[model samples]
Target: MADFNPGRDEVEDVAAMKREGDLSRFLRQQIRDGQARRDKPTAAPKPAPPPGYRPGAWPSGTSPPGPLPDRGADWDRALDRYRNGEGSDRDPCHCGACDTPDNNQTEEN
Candidate 1:
C-alpha cells in the first residue's frame, strides 16, 4: 500500500497528538480543513500590466502626462486648408504611401 510521508514538523506534531491520545481526531480535523480549503472558490487572476508599465513611477492618485492639447487656431487653420484644398504649410510628407505627382510639381513649374 502507498503511504503518505509527513514532513519532520508534521511527524513531531503527529507524535505529540499520538502521545495525547488524540492523533485520529487531529488527523480527521486536518482532513476536514484540507477539504474545506480545496472546496473554497479561488479569486480571479490579476491582470497583466500594460506594455512598458513601470510600477510606482507616478504618485498615488496621479497619472503620467497625456498628449498635449491641440492649439485651437492652428487646428482651425489646418482644417481650413484641408477644406479650401490648400496643402499643408509644412513641407509635403514624402512617405511613399501618399506620394503624388502634384506634390512634386512646384509653383515655378
Candidate 2:
C-alpha cells in the first residue's frame, strides 16, 4: 500500500477550506477568479492589411484555385472490391480439407 499523504500544506489547506462549506463558496471563488483573469486585456489587435489587399488572392491578381476533382467513384470501386474478397490470398477453407466435400469422401474410400 502507498501513503496517500504527500505532505503538501497548501493542498491540504485548500481541501480543508472546500470541506468547510458545501464546496459552493470554493466553486464561486474559482468562477470569479476565472472571469477576472479572462476580463483582463492581453494583447492589442493586429493592424489591418493595406488598402485594396484581397485576402488569399495571388500576387498576379488571380483568384485561388477551385475545389479538387471528385474521387467518389474510385472510392466506391475500392469498397466493392473489398466486399467481394477479390484481393484476399488467405486460405478460404474453414474445415481441414481445402477441396470440395465430394473429393474428400472419394479420397477416404
lDDT tens digits, residue span 1-109, model 2: 6765646996787678777864788779888998988866679899998877777776555667899999999999888766654444431543333454432333352
Single out the weakest 10-residue window by summed lDDT for candidate 1: 88-97
TM-score of candidate 2 relative to the true fold = 0.28
lDDT digits (tens) for residues 1-109 of candidate 1? 6799889998898889899999999879989998988866889999998776778687556788999987999999777767544554432563323456555436752
Q: What do the candidate models score in CA lDDT, each in turn? A: 0.73, 0.66
